[model samples]
Target: MCSGGFAKCLGITLIPLAVVCVLCNILLFFPGGKVVESDHITDEVWYSGGIFGSGVLMIFPALVFLGLKNNDCCGCCGNESCGRRFAMLSSILFATVGLVGAGYSVIVSAVAIDHGPKCLALEDGKSVWTYPFNTNGYLTDSTMWSKCTEPVGVVSWHLALFSVILIMGLIQIALCAVQVINGLLGALCGDCCGCCGGVSMFSYALDS
Candidate 1:
């Protein structure tokens, strides 16, 4: 019973996670929003594809979480077994997608932290110091160049967005885990009280 309430709380947390994922995806589509520059021929295609793919992947689990939240109660579909099965299947799917997205986000953030600053180096020995979205108009000016060494420790918009993605991804992973446990409880327990028994068993298993 308590586990169900915890799962419900977890589902509610995913609402904000979904919103942030959508916002990040939208921002990534704009010009100069990516960590890598788009001018290079070969690198352009690779970076563009990767950015778009990651953005798409990040949204999937968020949507799944939203769906789970919307259909949280049993008997909504008028069949207990059917509803339990659906919840189980959805939780499995969410867990799979959340794992992949979280892994991708972690890798992307690591790469960005490792290589993002290096990508700003221009051909004329100057580096462009622009943020992810460049909301301050710095990227609009052509003369916003400085020695790369001078801008150490400055956080860009891309990094900020990546950090948000990483946090959301982790939260999504945790929520999906809880959902899986809930689904399993519903599956093992035929009646409402059975769910409480399942939760007790689950908690005992954890405590052991």
Candidate 2:
């Protein structure tokens, strides 16, 4: 029962949420990878999609932990099943990392749209607006990439809304893992829990 329930939860929840977060990050950061010459995606902070995608990646191990944990509980009759504990702990740990990384992505994107120097914050806390190129000719020179004063064209609020939706879905997906955990515990403890494999009906997988 534990194994069945865990697989159901995973098929329905965790994997799907991670998928969305990864996709949204790709769209937000790359945006066709054109590197808006004017503003927005300055070289100062290539921090959009990458960070969020990494956060999404963190969930993979979590699903594994959850599945093994769930299965052991169901098969063992409450006899020292280690899988449940491992899965619960891993889910919480990885999900927390995902949340933190998501927050950073949001802050960086918001700051980039705010002001140029403010964009400096995402540059690992350095002034990307320096007057001259340091060495690598990317944007160090003030007259070159630094001289870019044009504003990044207004991005669609719809896109931002999509990002929000993606993150929310991510949270829902993480929350769904708890259901698997609960099911495992109930099975071992001889309580009640439901099979949730079909929960994926409402969840969409992240972009490829």
Candidate 3:
């Protein structure tokens, strides 16, 4: 019973969300993008790039499912009879991946913040900076800056992007759940009420 306008709005919103995720991942690929040094010191602190990258990649599949759901055709694969089932399965799988990826990213970031690099004791009246390490006990690409003086940009951007990814993953999971419920209801109705259930369920699955 959802309105066409509401469905269209939801579809449109997902496009930009997917695009932003892609863009953030792209930015993280470049040097000095995911990890930066403070202007006052040579110390470089790492961000959760690997975790964020994996999370964004995982969420991309969910976006594909959403796009398929929004399509006007019977199914993105062009199979009318079994299209709803296909969409339902895809949504469930991809949403699960997105949720797991986002959750892991958040956890890794928290750990990185907790064990971040600390400044070493002053040597000959000058404070020595230290480089951050990852969970693997290896040094990250991030190193001390010799000339840079600006505060680390990765801290703010990394947190903001991951927060967005987490929120979007939650939303995707809710939508996928609705799709599953609608599909189940439609199947039950079709069995009891004949063609009525099949038609309504198929349409609901697509619109959702």
Candidate 4:
């Protein structure tokens, strides 16, 4: 099938998602880590954010290197450069995707963290509720642990923070894999194009 408008639409939608996913991953890790582990969690956050954002979000702009370009002309000028549109769209999609991860992290933390002590503590004037952090690092309640009477089942903000960090870490690793693919694509395609078809073209914008 002919690839023109489809690439155009994809360039617009997909590139932004790529960018957003990077930010989303970072947001998810923060509240949970800060509330639970405090300073202890910083290293993990920095590590994961760097891996995902740099490994993934950083390279996401390269997506434009792969796809087609926009055929439609915009603005008052009737200039037609289809490849240029693809580059922009791929960049937008990658950036947007990078942010989606961050967005999910933020929203999930907002809700899940409500159960956390820092957030719950704000209610105040009641019992000081403590949630049990698991080896998995998920926050539940300590009562859940004592019932099992199992060894090595300690729970605390540290565990909870670690859990979120772990989740984000796993995601960052995955993003790294994706970035490798994009990186390869970038290398194969390079940044050279009569118009620089997909998203990688936007890299110039960032450099500027």
**Which candidate leads in lDDT?**
1
Q: Which pairs of residues collide in candidate 1?
A: 132-157
lDDT score of residue 118 within candidate 4: 26
Q: What lDDT tens digits, residue by residue, belong to model 1 across residues 1-208?
A: 4333444565566666656765664454332343334442112223432333334554565455445533534764788555645654566666566566656655655455334333334444555543232233333432432322323323354455555666666676666666666656544652242656787889999999
C-alpha lDDT of residue 99 in model 4? 48
Scanning candidate 1 in windows of ten residues, the lowest lDDT window is: 40-49
CA lDDT of 36 in candidate 1? 35
**Per-residue alpha-carbon lDDT of candidate 2 for residues 114-201, written as tens digits (9 for 90 to 100):** 3232122224454363322233343234343433222222233223534453455446445544544554454454322222333343
Local accuracy of candidate 4 as per-residue lDDT tens digits, 1-208: 1233333343354344444545544553454434334432323344444335333543443344234332233511543443344343344455455545444443443344443322222123443333322233333445544422211232244245434533553444354345434433432443232234434557766788
The candidate, 3 or 4, that scores higher on TM-score is 3
Evaluated at residue 207, the lDDT of candidate 2 is 28
Clashes of each: 1, 7, 4, 54
RMSD in Å for all candidates: 8.8, 11.8, 9.4, 13.3
**Model 3 lDDT per residue over 1-208, tens place:** 3222222334455455545645544444332342433432222113443335334544454455446434434654676435544444444455455445544544543444444333333444665544333242322323422212223454344345544544554554455345445445433432122455566889999999
Cα lDDT of all candidates, in order? 0.50, 0.43, 0.43, 0.40
Worst 10 residues of 4 by lDDT: 146-155
Task: Sort the predicted structures by lDDT, highest score first.
Answer: 1, 2, 3, 4
Q: Is candidate 1 or candidate 4 better by lDDT?
A: 1
Error of 4 at 135 (Å): 3.9
